[model samples]
Target: MWAVASLLPARRMLASAPRGDGRPVMLLPGLVNSDRSLFLMRRYLRRLGYDAVGWGLGRNLGARAIGGEGERLLARVARLHEESGQTVTLVGVSLGGIMARFVAHRLPEAVREVITISSPYAGDPRATRVWRMFERLTGERIDAEGVVARRVEIARPLPVPATAIWSRSDGLVNGLICRDPEEDGCRAIEVRSGHLGVQIRPAVLRTVADILAVPGQGPLGTFRP
Candidate 1:
């Protein structure tokens, strides 16, 4: 539904939106999804003049997918930082967003900021519709001691700038848990979208581009168009 709605409108939105500074932007896909899931978004960001790329680690299967302790993902960020000579911006969707937060927390210096779409890092994992699937795929129980500790770590305030784009109507996860209300460093943007729709929604794409265009601004800073 959102993919169809975003087709023409997304093009128009990008046409008039502000361009980027050629900084490297990495798009992370959700669980059970690969870079193919974010192809359109990556193309859109590229058209907006940013050096956008995928996580390059294939599908997101939690820590096991990125190497235990997220070493592989961290190495990817470091490599992008070295090659681009600038910090990288991470845009993650669903489970991808959780991984993005983990990476940002582990290596703040290499990251410019993080933008999450319908990611439920701040809430209980069991609140999501996919928790069982997550456990099956990752071989880690949601209620495990390590998993709970990791969640707390990721939910902590990030050292770098952060933004969370979520939808209350998201059917897969409880939307309220997507953003931490007490985290002043993390900006929250509410949009009308379902769990999957948030990724392709025209308004969400525009918001992301706008955020990327301006740096070191408050959450309510004017969007460039």
Candidate 2:
């Protein structure tokens, strides 16, 4: 039922969502998900005048996306920034949002802003429904010192503007923890949505479009929600 309901709203936003200034955007998918999961969002953003592209890293593999010496994920962001010759905005879902923050922190000059949907970067992994599964798939124990340190790093504010969109009804990650810790460089939007639908719901899509449409202020000092 949720899946069927999402289509109408998503379609509605596709037609009515505000257009942006053709800025380059990189859409990052959640953990264990692939670029295929973001195809619809990318298509919609493209139609709305933004140059949206995928991370092209296939299925997300947690830390590897942003860790190790030659990180393939960072390479992808760099390539996009170079190709577009403009600062890239990152729109990340779930774990992808955590990666986006890391990217913005590492390459602040190349990143313009970040928008996260249903991400638990500031939350405890144990509070998530799929925390165990994530640990299993990524082969990184949540209790490890290194893992905890990295999570702490991801929770910090980025040099650029940031926006976090979450819902109280989220079933996967505890919704309360899926918020921005600091409002100085970030703003939080509360929506009545499930974890899965937050990224595709019409209202959320419209909000994202509007956020991206803001001029020089980006969502930081401009967006109210």
Candidates in order, TM-scores: namely 0.94, 0.90
lDDT, model 1, position 92: 96
lDDT measured at residue 18 in model 2 versus the true structure, 0 to 100: 69
The lDDT values for all models are 0.85, 0.80
Model 2 earns a TM-score of 0.90
lDDT of 1 by residue, 1-225 (tens): 646565685576567889888899999999989999898789989998999999999878887779868899999999999999999999999999998999899999999999988999998888889999999998889888888888999999888889888778889999888888788778887777788756777877888888788754666322222
Best by TM-score: 1
Best lDDT among the predictions, by candidate number: 1
Model 2 misplaced regions, further than 4 Å:
9-14, 64-70, 215-225
Candidate 1 residue runs with Cα over 4 Å from true position: 220-225
Query: What TM-score number comes out for model 1?
Result: 0.94
Tell me the lDDT of model 1 at 133. Answer: 98
